[model samples]
Target: MASHSFQTVFAVPMTCGGCAKSVSDSLYKLDGINKVEANVKDQVVSVEGTAAPSAIVEAIQATGKDAILRGSGSSDSAAVSILESFFEPDARANQETPDDGVTRDVRGLARMVQVSPTSTLIDLTVHGVAPGSYRATIRQTGDLKDGAASTGGIWSDQGAGDGSGPRGLLGSFTVGPDGRGSAYINNPFQIWEAIGRAMVVSRQDESAGPLKNDPDTVVGVIARSAGVWDNDKSVCSCTGKTLWEERKDEVERGML
Candidate 1:
């Protein structure tokens, strides 16, 4: 893999050694990266290697932490592409698992505007989430056809954002006093293959207070692309004669 000596810095809120380890472990696994350093005292991570600033930031996010670009050694020489995603909330009918102590007052939407044969752009908007740190991740689905209404169901990390570190690590987000936040990421995944899968916004495990923690950090679902909904050929096949087609046929001969 080609590498650059670009050094990028980010401000992250790390509470202890474990949090720093999580950030390092997730970031070191990416290609083109050589070194990862996190200073808990400074609440910052300085990365040195040949990875794009955006990709490096994303890798750090997979660990349930947020990475913000401070400065890059290469300046503006890097080019990044962004694809849009479908945004929505999780299924609400299941309720298979209790939320533990997570608040459900939040509503969020995710969108992947476009995708190539193997990659996509993930954009998100969150409102009403308690102001703090949260994780956004994509998970393997058990049987849910649509992620938008999932109350509780089977979920496994889809591996990594681009098969490199972790899928659930779409990136970390923070809600402000207004209880809103937003994030954008470029990830590696096939949009079509991800349709039946699920994406969730979860509270950081360490951040969970008084309430016991469970997998229910889940907040909302990620929307699926338009193609996923249009796959059923029987819905609008465009081949059969419709009332409009028949009416036109009759009108041609004044049979109406």
Candidate 2:
């Protein structure tokens, strides 16, 4: 199905008009993009498209420049969740380590953008984990004190289902041999409906019941994300670090 178009803002370093034109041309080559605007002075690029934000970042990076997502969608249309694995200290110590000797509790990230009143786009990305199939779902509560166990049952939209089958099945995706995977999903719900809820990706299927005590299962609360033009800070006020500096830290933490 064709996804509804929304605007996404990206921070890209550009020194001149030529640089701006080059960035614009690169984005134009991508599918689902309808408009591209590159501002050299501001070092920012604005794109209107149905393409996933990851795809846009990849396209911009193809030009040998880094692309940082400043914001996406409009107003309160965007949301995000940082999926992390939860386990006991002993169990965590027993898990396999990465090749680089870095232990990452974070497994994936889910970016949600509401394009229309009834449809929302979810850009799910996972990395640094076992290569296998996993189910993605929205849970009823945001509590994570006990991990997935405290998140409650699957969340279903009012009057949408017959209440007989899997309730909040967003879908399933598979991680690859390189321990990386991504899925662009469209769900029949608005952004507001999912805020403060919990998103879980697990090795179990929908019929397996609530995910708990599973070392591989990852969960996070869905939180609001900044929209297009809503965030303009080049430096984080809390950490006092430049955006690129923070990006480097994120990279080390296995956040691709």
Candidate 3:
């Protein structure tokens, strides 16, 4: 079966912990509702599990309160968010050959999207490539080759299930007369799993072996939950924290 994990947020009015408990109890009783948390300070309730958005909204209404679908997604902010990253210059994430020592360049754009509860899609648009066929892969780190940070590497070709099996291929594209094209793959993994990784396009002939060591290949970032951070003040009282507070922790811990 396909993954059914989903997250839905509702605007619920609560005056105290008792109100929160009431809302939580009502939502928790519903089938497929894995986690139901209420925040009285934010006047919102966040539900995570396999339940549908409409059903979740209805369940919140059953508590004799109003429920608005403020957010519906898979994990965190990426559940319904679209993220984008760009390829680097030094990393062989591109295909460039010099003509009489006049070296050309490749430009790339990587997009990560959560199309459903259990699946995410990686879309790539690459330009300035040599006129030929090429393959793309998602790696563990978004760092470049000999980049200022740690050098980059690929986890597997198992992004869209069309490459090398199990570890499916992300997808392939052929450079056109304009030296650019687009490709996309629907990955079985969640958006969170790939949001912080690297996406690299390689030569079709295995001439570059693995993308990590390919001098012609470049490494670009795969950012997660790119948007939806506007005026978002939702908080967890149990942790006494909001997303901003958590980010502060990451910054202090050097995890961001």
- Give the top-scoring candidate (TM-score): 2
Candidate 3 structure quality by residue, lDDT tens digits, 1-256: 1145555566677899998998899878877778887889988788877555545555776878766445555335353211122234453445453123322233555545465644764445655556677777666575543331243444663444444453434657687877666664556676666655666676635444443333335445565443222335557567878655654553343221
Cα lDDT tens digits, model 2, 1-256, are: 4368999999999998988888899989988989999998899999998889988888888888898898999989999998887666664445554234334477789999988877889999987767899888899889876778788888865754445544467888898999888889987777887899999988775465656747678888999999999999999999999999999988776676
Q: Cα deviation in Å at residue 60, candidate 3?
A: 38
Candidate 3 accuracy as lDDT: 0.55
Candidate 1 versus the native: TM-score?
Answer: 0.39
Worst 10 residues of 3 by lDDT: 79-88
Question: Model 3, 124: alpha-carbon shift in Å?
Answer: 1.5
Name the regions of candidate 3 deviating beyond 4 angstroms. 1-106, 145-153, 157-168, 204-208, 212-216, 227-256
Query: What are the runs in model 1 whose C-alpha is more than 4 Å off?
Result: 1-106, 142-163, 206-223, 227-256
Give the Cα RMSD of candidate 1: 19.7
TM-score of each: 0.39, 0.88, 0.44
Best by lDDT: 2
Candidates sorted by lDDT, best first: 2, 3, 1
lDDT of each: 0.51, 0.84, 0.55
CA lDDT, candidate 2, residue 4: 87
